[model samples]
Target chain A: MQKHRGIRSTGIPENILGYLMVAPALLCILLIAIYPVFRTFSLSLTDMKMQFPNMAKYIGLDNYISLLQNDRFWSATYNTLFFTVVSVALELVIGFVMALIMNMPFKGRGLVRAAVLVPWAVPTTISATMWKFMYHDQFGVINDILFRMGFIDQYQSWLGSTSSALWCAIIADVWKTAPFMGLLLLAGLQTIPAELYEAATVDGASKVKQFFRVTLPLVMPTMLVALIFRTLDAFRVFDLIFVLTGGGPGNSTETLSMYAYTTLFRNLNFGMGSAIAVLIFIFIFLISLVYIHLLSRQND
Target chain B: MHKSRWSNIIFYVGVVIFIAIIVFPFYWLIITSFKPPEQLWDIPPTWWPSRFYLGSYIAAFTERPFLTYLKNSIIVATSTTAFAVFVTSFAGYALARLHFKGKNAILALALSVSMFPGIAIVSPLFLMMKEWNLLNSYIGLILTYTTITIPLSMWNLTTFFRTIPADLEEAAKVDGASPFYTFIRIILPLAAPGIFTTAILVFIAAWNEFLFALTFNTEDALRTVPVGIAMFPGQYTLPWGDISAASVVVVLPLIIMVLLFQQRIVSGLTAGAVKG
Candidate 1:
């Protein structure tokens, strides 16, 4: 008990010491993460082309106005939203099934778990590239397999056509990320006690009913959290699209992040690029707000 | 009994199919790495390479400065892990054990920062790096990586530090040990497993990061593995062989790490999600 007094009587006050301890990390976040976001917001207000930095000037809401009228921006937004909704929906379903399978008492579960980590462990660029090769129009295994199975009469260019390119990218994304979602849901599933399931079974509930009644309700919070995480991640899809199709067959698969990269780096349109970047930040910020609200509700 | 048998068959079949879907791409990657160019372009791709032709692996290293990319990735990832772990340990300790004002605010800040879309901050970070003349340097990427890695590391370490009893710290305090001193000498060693877990996760993240690495370091010599493999010249013909080989080289170490530290990684990842 006297030892507690010793801690209090130390030279530096605990609050100040705490602040000092956290200063470096806080500074890093503010400078590298928080400040840059504000900088991008301000940059979005100016007509700052990277090529001619000297001609930069404040052009209040013109960039945003133009972005609203620009068909490309709308298309990119549509593409991003579509990708997010489709891929996240697929990931959630596939990942939920994976979780259910993983939660079952099975032999060689460790090996299955490790195997599931393969896609998640691979870098996004690498996985995208791998899938790109597999979707190669002429020499692709996917085309070969589909043809052999009599699914298609001719080998189709999966990534070379606009109609199918985005879907192809979504498939690749679901493949890469479903494992991660599975892992998160598996953690959630593990926390559910076996007693509840046993109790449900004893009450003459079928397996399917037990899942809907016992499993789903308890895991709802975790699923919601995982859903938002994947939604936000899917919304920011960049590396996969970058390497897989370079947001092409046209701008068909161009995500907001990819569009921002092209504008900022390739086209060197700093202001427009920043505008796009700011929109992405806003979208992600809103998604995060929903997450926080959900989390708070769960806590209550 | 009949119903149980039917369910058992379905369960095993589901497990097998799921595992196959998950493992097929990796198997494809490994096989492609060893395939000769002739076999790679076969009408129907060969499921198995006829021979272990090591040409692609050799070419991947020799054709481009891949060794440099590998070196850069190692330097950036290791430096980021070291810097992030050092910075976050103190913050975690403070948040976990200390009685302080605005602790919740800081925690909330960290949580939100973890979810920040990198595309938003990238442009300004690029300009800042340019202004500081760090665009092509390891320091620029390392600093940026530390920023992104800090929040999770803080959360994870704080969760870990909370599990450790305060009685040990009190005893150390009574023996005239300074808080900082007790932290470095006593607390850190005690939290080594948590710290190591955080380090592995952070290292994997830094290793696999693409957007920042791609944006900041455009110089050929400065590229990391992800960017290097991605930006491989395919002007005439895409070098599938070399690219696959390079992918294998980079992915092998990560696979090994995940295998060795599977349980630790799971717990570390879910620490924030499950408990928060």
Candidate 2:
């Protein structure tokens, strides 16, 4: 039935009738997605700030040049990459393992499967706070557990130190985000037919061999698809870092989104904000292009 | 084969530990919410509350107009979701089913628009909202959220709508129903899962939304859950216990909804990921 459903979408006719059918939504997407982005590009060229919008000057890529020379932009760029690369890579590995575990036949698996999603379901801000509390210097759950185990005599201020805070933020992110990766990969795992694995088993291929030869190849595409999604989201993350550390302890956890936001809102420097916005957009667009290429192959 | 059975046990145990780690923060919140103010900050860290105290929620209710904020969030979220789904379905149906002159181009344009960072236009949108006098109003938040939500909802729902058989629509039309009625009666009902998925996805997105809610709404009366929680800690700082309890209160519903309808929600999320 599903196979038949896929092959026969060709019969629907195009009509002004069909166009009228969907105009409201098309217009909304147009105005929201396309128009504002273009406006942002235009706004990037101007010397606009909060004080006076009407008397803005068009300086033509000077903002971009100034952003290139700024130490803060480079720092944010490095931090964003560190966050994205480490988190997405870890998520992919952890998520794949969890996906494999959940696919196995077991008792009370339903309950366990549902429970794993709780972290993913928790709003990122709340989860950050949850972990923030857990990581507190004196009274945190993490400190309690570590203290009980005699890991250290003195309490650690996880969010206070410059060297450790960003990594701590990454840990909070990984804890909340890995479940999401696991779920996406698990769905991918379900799509691979069982018969191939059975045939491999009958041939006396070792379980690891069967997995490498069959599962890994089949799941890579899906993992690639999932990776693109997580990376983009991680790159744009603001609320979690904002609430957890406020990009604090000497700017250790600042990402492009927070920097752009602080520039626009805190300093009211629209020009610098728009320049950072363009840079982030360019980086995302380049990666998205790679994903789009992968997608094109998948569709074909 | 029997040798690896031990490995299977190892895998299950490992998975259990992982899931436990995943769930503990939220579990902590629940326990914290019902604990008394005095015991909220236990030194040795009490694993469970001896008794459930309902007063934290009461204070959460009484300390501020909790119900009013909840109502405002619902109205804004519901309206945005409704407008978004209604608009996206028609637009998605059109893009998917109709042979528009710019069908492929339209889809490409939609995808491209998503490239711009939300912060870039935020200033402009902020200015635009102020110019139009929508700051602090539900209408303002709704419009701002709608811009993001509509694109988001449409992108995912369109993928689902495109999968439906068009012959069903054609048959409904052949029975003398206008295309509008046919869409309303035939296509929409069959697309219930997609619609509901859209609703759940939109609700969570709206409920979790923060920047606009915080920056756009100045009055205490207009805050939503995210903003509510952001301000929650400050308001009850003197009583650290109540603040933790209230943080739990703010997030509890979202956690519950996502856990209960987890399968649907995950699928909706991946549809966004997989397609976009």
Candidate 3:
């Protein structure tokens, strides 16, 4: 309703007025969010370790080159991608089913919906630690349940080994984040008109047929958007892995973000750390571009 | 009718499974928090604690300055929420109501910034904070948290403000009310639900934030809940019981908030997510 007229009574231009309204926020964001990013790029090229403190010299492309050849960096990248792909895939299927169930005409649906959000609302650090307790080899309930269900022969350390540690972290991530995907997809489901379903029923389509023909087609865009969002979040995951395994069992669950954190803080290698950080930023930027490209193609 | 009945059964089964997956972890968190240290390492984990033990909770309070952690968490979360909401309201209002140049660009930039890896900037931001004498302080953590939360809140509040009816603002303006007056009195009151939703979301994020809290706050007195719990040291052993109790303390407020405001949280989440 507040249209941008050419000029106000005091002769202030409309564009300037709009800019003034948004300036404070934009300034905060630029100062806090955007500027540090550029600074990170500058730090990546220099050998700046916290321990050294005095000598700060730019050795251009050396950080990036060394990082590219580093086995630990490559391994961390693999772990990150593997975790993101697997967790996002699981969350997609599980979340879609959850969304469909939420859309159904059922008693206590509101209660069920609220119940589902418990996982998403719980902090990642807490959930990761909670899962760490649950995965304890000696006393974990997971091993107990699995042994009872004849899934595992004996109690095993879920986070103690390199192979199983990443999977364990993945499982925790899936549990925590699937509800977020479900919430997003449920929003998409709510937009569809009931008349479409009625029409499908009148045409003698089965429920499965209706889902494939109507629901899937209609909700696919939303599903992809959710996928992209989850992918980005998963790729940069640090808290879950940090708390669950500390990227341990020999860096089995190490992600790029974890790698960056370790180098920046633990090792105090700011030069290499910033390089990893910039690579992460570029990876996310590229992934988002691909997703947006797909989105635009869909619009056409 | 038979087909409908079968489908109903299937629906109920799905609901059961979904609820089970979501609720099981929290149930374990609660049970673990209450379990005695001995029971915690039992051969087969006890599903229920032995007679509702309160030792862990007491330890959570006494052993290490956990109450300090709680106090700091509350301060940081509340401050970050208040600051983020206050700052984003203007930008959100402009994006939603005022037509301006570079609006879409600003929105896109904000969205991109949302994806900016917080880890990437931590080095510089850390150095900057140290230079500013803000490292290990509430203001440092709050300001950093604001940067992360602002983008998400901006997108959410912008979408939310756009949903309010335009006619009300038009009527207020027709009554010769100043733009600021109308925004403060008419528009803001109307956007209460959106603002509340955004505030809760930001609060939860700041409360849960670990890296910034852990990196910035080295002093035990200033540490927030997540960092405190993560860095919680034990004298004799790993202190699983105390850690569990601390986890519960960190998450219980969030669980309560989520359950109480499920509808608004869901809507807020969906609104930001749907357009993506």
Whole-model lDDT values for every prediction: 0.91, 0.77, 0.86
Model 1 segments more than 4 A misplaced: A1-10
Better of 1 and 2 by lDDT: 1
lDDT of 3: 0.86
Q: Comparing candidate 1 with candidate 3, which one achieves the higher TM-score?
A: 1
State how far residue B13 of model 3 sits from its true place (Å): 3.5
Q: Which docking class does model 1 fall in? A: medium
Judged by whole-model lDDT over C-alpha atoms, candidate 1 comes out at 0.91
Top model number, TM-score: 1
Estimated TM-score for each candidate: 0.97, 0.91, 0.95
lDDT tens per residue, model 2, B1-276: 987999888877887798788777877777777878777667867778879998887887788666677788889989988877777888777776656587777666666665545765676677778889998899988876776777667777778878889898888655555555666667778888988988888877777787778778868888876676666666444444555666776666776787688778878877755333
After superposition, the stretches of candidate 3 with alpha carbons farther than 4 Å from their true spots are: A1-13, B1-7, B233-236
Clashing pairs in 1: none
TM-score of chain B of 2: 0.89
* Sequence-dependent TM-score of model 3: 0.95
In candidate 2, which residue ranges exceed 4 Å CA deviation? A1-14, A294-300, B1-5, B114-116, B235-239, B271-276
Give the TM-score of chain A, superposed on the true chain A, for all candidates in the order listed: 0.95, 0.92, 0.94
Candidate 3, B19: how far from true, in Å? Answer: 1.6
iRMS, candidate 3, in Å: value is 2.8
